[model samples]
Target chain A: MTLEIQNASARAGGREIVHNLDLALAAGEIVAVVGPNGAGKSTLLKLACGLMPLHGGEIRFDGSKIGSLSAGELSRRRALLPQECPMRARFTALELVLMGTAISGQGRPMAERVAIAQDTLDRVGLSSFMERDIMTLSGGERQRVHLARVLAQLEAAARNGAPGCLLLDEPLSAQDMARQRLILQIAKMHAAHGGSVLLVLHDLNWAAACADRIVVMHQGRIQSHGLPRDILTSELLHDVFGIPDGCIHQHCSTGRPFVVPHDLVMPEDINKRETPCILQ
Target chain B: MRAMRVHAGWILLSLLPLLILVMLVAVEVGASGAGIGTLLHAPDVATRNLAWMVIAHIRAPRVVLAAMAGAALGAAGATMQGLFRNPLADPGLIGVSSGAALAASCVIVLGVDMAQSGFLNGWAVPLAGMLGSFLVTLLLYVFATRAGITSVTTVLLAGVAFGAFSGALTGILIFRANDTALRDLTFWTLGSFSGANWERIGLLSPFLVLAGVIATRLAVPLNAMLLGEADAALMGYPVERTKRLAMLGVAASVGPVVAFVGAIGFVGVVVPHLVRLVTGPDHRLVLPGSALLGAILLTAADTIARLVAAPAELPVGIITAALGTPVFVWLLSRIHGADIPS
Candidate 1:
């Protein structure tokens, strides 16, 4: 029950973004794609979700080309949270979550969908804020609303025991420290519950801890792919991220390989600019 | 709830006086400002013939035509606001009305006499205007949006560009016109319910009703759309299709009204907003309320237009602006710097 990408390529305005990338994620597994800025992390997620047309190769979910799926079918299988979706409406947390299923064309009665959305909000620890407007919420709370929406899609998909795929593009990037770890734990719980996840995260330490496999990307190409401990090595980090050796240390707590940078370096030092960090 | 009932009561009480005044003024202006109604009902050959000519051929059709045109413009404005997800989106503000005006002016100046059977005259200009509006709006939508999603900023910027261009072209056409052509074009641009007739009323009615119904059907999707395209698309909506449909619906509704009325402004922009303030932003309630409020507001304005000049009869558009501008300023001043959502 794994999703596979075979030599998949995508280009925007004739400029290649994701180049000949191949990936496979087993059901109930979490894969994190870490890359330097302009390494096309978001583009890869866009390609996977069929938001952008693939220039070459294929993406298959359960051995079928994802391109052939109807928009509704594709949405039912996987949900994508774009890097910056600024919704204008001042809906409650529950309504925002309901919109996720709405994309899949749930077309259920408003009351039932509202109930499901409220339940999802409660599960995501936003029960008390069910009636509060999303615009009034903090960035962390909004991210949780986003997560709850995606998780709601999965929970609804659980009837046939088919785990939904959550494709999050830098879900925790805009979030603070405490919310970041909380989101990672929630993602881990989704995977543990037999759901699939493919995340684009800059924080390698969090990915190393939570992800089942780590795929390192450099210049739109895969640099390494393996378990976190095997792939997130000092030499690979220096080569891909331009981090000097021994600067970022891997610390294990709760039996996860967590890494952190001991030194401060501007992301521009890597010479790629589009990748966003929470600091600014 | 009591407030709504009061608003409704005010509308109803005000509506009766408006209807009577519209009927009286339309009769007085269309013919000589005389006691034509009493004279026509006088049971004499010339009197009865004149009454039939004035009432059947003129005033009744004009009042109904004004009502239909007003309703259509108001509804279209509501739809455009829903389309932009911006409360300030008025049909006239974006130049859909100007595009329609230009088409209508051309038809009038060129004198495309479609009244061969005498039954289709009122409809001919409106049809031309709707076609022109459809063309211009379609072009704007195509040029503004590169992909499936339309960036709001891009749409607005493009609208301003197109609107200015269309207005310039309309000015050029008017400038080049002869005396009679200029006079005809002037009233059309200033907005008139003066050219009201059975044919015009009939032509606008179906389009208005259909556009209103289609907009209501889209209310749920439109509300979801304000959350953003990605969010709307995820919510089982055909986001791109919905946007296109709503834009087309706005043009379809607004185009004919503008063609006939000559750029009636403000009602579309103001009525929905006022409704939103009372009912919150739910389109389900907003669409219907905007339509009703628009009809009532326009009828009142036209009645005032007749009363203000009494004998001369200034255009309804003038009255609407005179009354609505202060309200617009008040609404604007009331906003305590809420962040403008992009």
Candidate 2:
């Protein structure tokens, strides 16, 4: 396994946030973690990346313990993209992307770093934003810019023969449909190029479509884990997510699973008592 | 968008000649009618010799002191703003100046002439000022952060409280000071460069130069920090180390200037923001650009302070604060109205 989490647990604010989660990833594969809100998807990613302290068990990267590696060494092998990055300074997209070379420690010259940043931006479909200020970019564009930065970091790490793992927490939440597809294609390309990806995705359809395997989480525990085609069945959806009936369907041409959620009406009794604030 | 359009490196290079020209003009504008032309070639040997004496002994040290102090404050201001990711994060605004001033005032009020006496081996005043600023900064760090995330509003408010508290203590010291010490205290609080002898300059240059170099080298990490501390750490930066460097740089840079020059205002508050508006917010540009502009701004302000009242001069701090307050107000309104990050 290029990345391994063995019986790990994480706590925040004196509450067990992620309990007894074990997952492993090999090179050249994409794994999507799908779950409802507050299911500890983000917490798991944080714990795995060592951003948060693990309360129990252990995590290893390339057979070395995560606790044993320094932040620089760990960053060289893996990169994480949080859901949102707050930017106050007016760094251009190029300068911001070039910051990915920070941990990799200046082996390449300035020109090479710039070129890699530009190439990564182009791959993420932000070719024209290289000189534009990051603050001027839209929400979706900024997300793609950070995506470019992560890809550039992983690419540089791969050159050193280090394990390359990308951990993204809700990276596509702010992206549009087309940009979401582009981001997925980029993730798949990374996996195809011998990198491992573990991304938290809220949309089950996208997760089912792009992930080689899916791990469904509920209330800080893994509910199910298997091939998407087998695990994303109507019964599993009903049992895990409480979505009943023919809400899930297989595409006629590609045989990929998708969700429609046609019967999403609130129950009459539940609406009177619990739905005081309806989501508009 | 148009405000930050200039290329910072080109702008800095272009401003260098102008800064030198301004400094040359400033050195000649004084009570003594010794101009640079007179210093170079005068009609008589005696006149030329007097001009050389004026240039070498008095004007040169004063100009050098202004430039060095300005550069230190400017770069320190830029570092603070970048570290906090707030446009209003100036060393003066964040209790550094008042803290240092209070420490110096205590030393003076107690009649401890450490520069002459063997109390701290002639290093008591500057060392005390530096220690005071460091402690206040540590207090600020503790008060303004919750769960490793910094709250800019909390920091600003805490700074205001700390400044007020320090001001009250300084007022008590002033009330207790003797007449001779009172005269010194009054001038020091208002700020001046009259103490800019070669010896003081020699004592202060190493600290200023060290701080400037460290701040300039921190450009890359400060840029990362602008993306927020958590994001900077995720990008493989040692965020704690960067924060420590920034805080220490602020103390080392501000303490000596405050100690020697007596709490010059507005330059630290204004220079970095103006430089940012001109250079965009990239620290690679902001840090160096601020240093250059700061040197220019202070030298000009000091020159005005010298010449505006003939033989009697205005305090340079009053000049800077007079010039800086309106611009600061404009900046406040612009940031508030536009919801720009402060």
Candidate 3:
């Protein structure tokens, strides 16, 4: 099944934070949406997940309007692991993962669901911290637990060939190098199992290395959408990012994307002085 | 081998009966000394009847209502604290109880004589009181909830505004009331169970039980809520609706308690925190635990309030404030230095 956003937009405080934008995701595909700050990448994901009200446009899954689905039904299809997930209640690593399975399997025996949760924890490499409180875990560890919860959500949703999709808003913001790779690797597994993923990432190289496709966002609009090699060029990067063609990547044994500042080209020269810029 | 000793299972087992004990004891004992023996005696005996009448009819109703009030306030306080994500929040200080107080006060001060003169008997009082509480709470809730969710700051602000409006009206009514009425109104504002009777008790029992059941049922939902709405929602919770239902339940339950029992200050704010410390943020534990703890604290306070003056009486709210505030402060300090409620 495919998850699609049809002209989805979000208005906060009567101003459109995310204007009308359309996108779609195919099974086993991980798409990274990269944008400058305030580009509405996060809002788009929220709108699709029904976390935010539909200010305008419609979100659909497998050609069905998302608004038509029940809250429980919608949750069973896709899960979102939000960026700022500092919990008001700190659950144990196992308990946090248990929550993901709990929602879909609410009718099942509690012990049964709990057993599934333990398995998910083991899969996420958090079996050792199952009983450890979330507070004791460092930032990277918490992210793993959250990602584990997302995996459990999908696992519960995997009944009767249900669509398993994950929408992550900067899932790796506060993590170290190892944790970042670990999260993306888990996401890739979720996709390989016929799930779809829409990731909002600031790190272009990480996105390039992980995502099958990349979408570039600018000021609440999508500037370009294509394969990583097709879109992560010097021109698009400099124009949308104003990166001065400086180093963002380095030679990597891991075959990861890295940038080196070959020359410090000005935005004016890059854009051919066509667009008026206020930024210095 | 260790599978035999689950701490949570044992705690739940112990706590369930403790909840029942608090409820039964609070309703059984009173000025009549209707404790273990008296509660079980035959109603035909004169002393038994007198004790029964006093216990079941007089103090029992009041104590039952007090427990209901305490539970609702505690539940509401817990929900509001979660909503605002602030542990220090109190509905009275933030002004929800005052708003209800204002609404109820308007009925007590103004509607009393008119309803009596109409020969409607006491029905009009509760009706008017209920109307006042419902209207003010509804208005305040509406005012506070702008976006889908109700923030603590907005709810607190709206409560303050609504409370001030109600308080000012209460002042006006007090000024207009006759000397006896003014004196009576003073007791009502401070909160007392003196007027409690079986009819009032019977009338209130359903609301209390219904609300309490629903509130207790919210333990799991509330446990999920501690993760905050968005994360909870993504984890398969309907975020906005969960919040709305909780708010409605708290308001509907607590507004009446405030109306009946003046502002029983700090029971809501104090009990939940204490329950959380003992049981952690698992609402399955905290909600029921808070209900029992609130009932125990309020009933004890009410008993002490009665005993302290012996033949005279003190407002239960004062006793609760006098005792609860210090205990609450101690709890705050103990939970301190640890942030984010682990």
Candidate 4:
């Protein structure tokens, strides 16, 4: 499936949050979106997933306009994981995950849907937590359960012969380091299975390590989009993210550029130093 | 540690016998001294006939009506809670009971002589109550929904405002009411199954059935909705349609029950929580389990109401609130640190 966003502009509370943004995701590809806070990263993801309406332009999934497809039809082709899901009801982990398959598993048997939910939970290393109440789980654990839910949605869609897209926003924010790697690995596996993943991420190093291409955003517009090696430069970081020039370095083994903000001037020291400071 | 939750199907299956037992107990324990033994083995045929008449016509209908109203409230409560994604959301949260009460008060104070007007005798108040509830629901939808999407927060706040407005109107009608009208309004507000009969049951059945079907179909979508609206939509459930169906279901079911039996509280708010404690949060279980458990609780409460004052019956609503408060507080204490959102 090819998910395309063509010159899309999204507004929130009558003000434009995403302006004339253009991007696309093909099957078997993983694209990571990196941007500073308030850069419209989450809004862009919401627009792509049809959760937010575009002020102008349009979004299409598999050559069909998003507005043309019914919600059920669109969901069969894509799933979204928001930044945070605040659940007030006490649902078991398996029950919450099973909800993900509700739409795509309409004609499928109950056993198959349950199996898919279980499989996704197991993939996220939550096999033992299937019956645990989500309220009792820690924040990171709850986040993984939701991640499993998102994966289960796509897994059911794939089983129906329509491998779809995943639009995740800050999926790793609540996770620990190992689980973060585990989540990115799961995304990679989804891409390997001919599904596409477009995830908004804050950690530049992980973005560089996992993404096939990196898209940078600043002030609701795409600043740059290219291979990780070409995109992760000190000049781009200094311009867009206000990082110091020496912070971007190529990893010795993978040759991927990783950011080391350690020796950089802190915000308070920016005016005292000769380093160009673009942050205002 | 969490208590072991019974499987939803088993809980549903087990509730059938329990409900029957509660209904039988409710039927047997009333103000009348006639028991099952009196119906079967009275000393004379005349006495047996009297026993049978009282049991079948009076106790049976009242018990069955109580069960029906309880089941409607329970299922509606579950649906409302699921739709709002708030554990505290009650069926009455959407102004159904208040609106119905306002309309019923209007009918009573106006002294509509429907018996002479060729209308269905004694049907005006209930029909007006139903209309009032539907109108409030419609107004809420118009005010809270923009385009196709309904904001849950807006719906919640607007429902409270509408409920207060209706309550104020009802108070005005109460002020203008005569002695008889005031007494009738008082009984209606406190709620009772004293008016239950075959005809009232027939009138309430269709609305309850319609609401039940809608609530049953909403189980999966409601489960998806616990993840929140955007996520529910992404999961392929029609979020907007689900919200509309839920509001309609609650209004259709709860309206008639309040119209027929006055305004019973606590059953709608507490029964679902009780069901969730035993069956977890899956609506497939919570909905049906709620219907059964609610029937049992309300039937038992009505029996208590009947027996408490012997010949003079207490309104069942008083019993529900009196009994429901302790149980609800105990439940809160039990799940306090674990489940309640901060």
The number of the candidate with the highest lDDT is 4
Q: What is the lDDT of candidate 1?
A: 0.72
TM-scores for chain B, listed for all candidates: 0.81, 0.87, 0.84, 0.95
TM-score for candidate 3: 0.86
* TM-score against truth, every candidate: 0.83, 0.90, 0.86, 0.94
TM-score of 1: 0.83
lDDT of 4 by residue, B1-342 (tens): 123555557767888999998899877776779989899889899999989999999999999999999999999988888887776888878888888888888898885565226665778778888888888878888888899788988988888888898889989998998988888898899999998899999989999889988987898888777777878888889889989999999999998899889999899889998888777777888889888888999999999999999899898889999999999899888877664321
Which is the better candidate, 2 or 4, if ranked by DockQ? Answer: 4
Summarize candidate 3's per-residue lDDT along B233-263 as a digit string, tens digits.
6676766676666666676677667666666
Taking the tens digit of each residue's C-alpha lDDT, what string does model 1 give over B19-88?
5665566555543443566554676877767766766676667667666666666667766777777767
Candidate 3 on A1-280: residue-level lDDT in tens?
5898878778899888887788999988899999888888888888878888987888888778888888777778888888877775656777778778877776777787778778778876788888887888888778778877877777776765744788998989888888788789978887888889999999888898899999998998888899876787778768988877645453345544555554666766886866784332
Residue A267 Cα positional deviation in candidate 1, in Å, after optimal superposition: 25
Local distance difference test, each candidate = 0.72, 0.81, 0.73, 0.87
lDDT of model 1 at position A245: 75
DockQ of each: 0.24, 0.41, 0.40, 0.52
Query: Per-residue lDDT tens digits of candidate 2, residues B98-150?
Result: 77878878887884666457757545666677677767877887887787655
In model 3, what lDDT does residue A214 have?
Answer: 91
* RMSD to the hidden true structure, all candidates: 6.7, 5.2, 6.3, 4.1
Sort by lDDT, best first.
Answer: 4, 2, 3, 1
What local lDDT score does residue A179 receive in model 2, on the 0 to 100 scale?
88
Order of models, best TM-score first: 4, 2, 3, 1
